[model samples]
Target: MKVHLLIQRTFAGLNTEYTSNPAIAQLDNKLFLTDERSVVMQITENPVFSFAKNEKWTCYSFIKRALDREKRAGFYAVRLFISSAHKLTNVKDCLLTIAQRYEFFIQNNTPSQEYTDLLTQINEKAIIEKERYTFDIESIRKGTYYAIATAENLEALFADERNEFVEKLYLFTTNIDSKLLAEFHLHSIDPLSVVKWQINDEKKALDKLWLENTAIPVFAKKLLSLQGAKLYFQLKGQQEKRELTGTNELKTTALIIDDADKCITSLKINNTAVKPQPYFELYALATDTLYYTLKNGKEIPLPITAKLSTRKLIVENSENALAKLWVNGEELPIPTGKKFEIYALTTDKIEYTIVGQAGKKTTVNSDIKTLSIHLPNRGQTINDNKKSPVIDILLYALLSLLVGGIIGYFYRSNTSEEDISAIEQKIQEKEAKYEQVKKELNSSQILPNNTATKTVTSTTTNTIKSNNTTTKTTNVATKTTNTNSKTTK
Candidate 1:
């Protein structure tokens, strides 16, 4: 048997053209049509209709178009036309069964439930939109199942199931055409897999690599070298000290002398199998004062100024014996007992010598000097020529006189200037006071002279008034007398 299918892509509210055979011309303008071969058919006006065979068309045309146009495409409406040489019951059953089975297949294979429900609802909606076309099963190949899907709704119908269908066909089918399978090119390789493979390769390379332990050996060698040198110097010093001391027990005293003046600032004595008295008494010649403890617990002061010269012992005081001087098993002769001073220019190499009694009496009392004598030629000399005592005294006296004269001159000049300024200030003040007194005296003379003039004028006016009053009284008496005489007549 053979089945013929027609798929179409049409816009909404538009008619689509499809044909199975020339005898199917009755499908025009018809909502649904059934043939004598028990074929049931339906025509749907829904533009979203899609079938599994034509799934790619829906994705390319309708779904993409809808997305571009920003509109929602409805469920796929497939114009299913089922025909068979069997009875209508068998044909309907077979068609419905296929439809139901395809719905289940799509739902299982698809990525989303919404698309499966849409396809199932499209199948159920076929009865109402009855513009149907029918076909006989004999018209298609025998035992072949055919499906038609319109391109407009292809994406909506098979957007999720396309890849799954391709995979199934690839896995199950034999003698499948490569071109046909390639049409549904849907499988995509994951990009992260490639990156992960590269990272794994790099990690393998890093695991096989090695690094040298350079720092540890270098540091250890440096430390070992330093330790060896330190041990060498310590051993050398011990050897020198052992050679310097014989089998006899000797007390050792160390003194640190300053390089500038060769002054001894600190001293330490180490006595083993030797008495402290011998050590103290032996080293007393180093300084002017030697301090010792008496049996009464009193500290006694001894003055000693003697030093060892080249193979000879010299004492500052002639009473001190120099013939018995022997130091470190070396015998020394007695000199004229004149004190000789030694000096070192630089601090790098210090000179040290030992002095003791010449004869081995096994217990000879001796004195040693730990002197820090200053070197005359070590530092720069301002005056080299030695002057007589009288000339030095005269020079000191002249310098003092010169300094005193300069100081006295400065002091007298400063005092005289201050006194002159004070005297001038006093004279100016006294002259100002004299000028003010003269002005006051001239003003007093003018006021008294004007008052005396005013007094004389007042006295003259009083005398004239008295004389006029007397004259008036006399004239009035004469008039009265004349009147009385007239009255009598």
Candidate 2:
């Protein structure tokens, strides 16, 4: 079941990809697969590299070698264009099936309905093997599933699948209209690579595809050596405004985040968790380069797995009195008393409950912009700490007294003209009243009762204290009752 895809030797950064699904090529009804045709050099290594001469000589030598090799080794071999998953248990039947399909198409220019039904049945019943190779009539292994790689000085046909930390690949080209991914020269495929890009000398980001197949694992190793790269690619859909209905089966743009550096403590895509291939980069691209339209109506070179980071969330609370914290309806495990800068999205709903005699819940949505999560003090309730009623009343009373005293002190301290005049008038009136009282005492001879003059002189005193000192006032009044009989003096 070996097949060949039309590709060309490129002269810059190489990109390798493949696909088992027919929709990726936008040819669900029809598929194109071929056998290894005429070529000159070994299909794996670029023959141009053999000649360290000028670029022109390099390409010339490579193609010449391929042509020579094809003439020497070309033979009729059984190749297949299968759409189903199957094992090569019976090689004779499989080859016959391929021949039948090819012959029928050559005669009718399209597969008959019966032939299409057979293809579907084969795909369904095929026992897909992991090695990606098919056994011949002699049980010999041949790469049945493989990919085509296009890059600088390299046009290779390999069967090994890339299992690395490559999430997605971006193929940038000046040729915005070029639909197919091919070598810069070949024209046999439906659409060829006529795209050009104005890249700089540093090559910050050249026209890159999803996975550099072997290059990614090599880069993954390098990334591990450098403690990992924060680079990422996200899975995207092919349509711009496609609804996210559950039935719409979305595919990953690229595949695998092969833990090059082991920094990713966790990984999830669209809610499905996937493990990364350790010590590798991205799995090799299975199909050709794909393009997806985004919501902005712009054609992005995508539908590949890409790099995206998890949002950070930090938890802080007084005494760390937090029990359960729910985020977006999911309880997020918060370790006790552990100082860590965790990450989560801010748009996600955040709520928490305190731990104590009464566990109360609270929200973490005060500052959505800032990433910090600070919970209230453990004892601090949503309605502040409850105080005793007595204490509250005392506090209020003290506050009122203090205010009244302040007002009185200020009023007494101010010697306004009006206050002075009022005081003087009172003093004059008091003096006049004192004079009148003296006259009355002289004219009326006001007297007290005279009885045995019980002069039991009792001294009474009233004391008023200010700060720490006391002022005393004493008053004495004697009353005598007159007796008609002489007092028994």
lDDT of 1 by residue, 143-191 (tens): 1111233334323323322221221111111123335434434122111
TM-score of each: 0.12, 0.23
Tell me the tens digit of each residue's lDDT in model 2 across 297-359.
233232334432224444554355566777667776776564544444334476777655235
Task: Give, for candidate 1, the lowest lDDT window spanning 10 residues.
Answer: 190-199
Residue 346 in candidate 1, Cα distance off native in Å: 99
Q: Give the C-alpha miss distance for residue 482 in model 2, angstroms.
A: 28
lDDT of 1 at 301: 39
User: Model 1 — TM-score against the truth?
Assistant: 0.12
- How many backbone collisions does model 1 have? 26
lDDT score of residue 65 within candidate 1:
15
Worst 10 residues of 2 by lDDT: 456-465
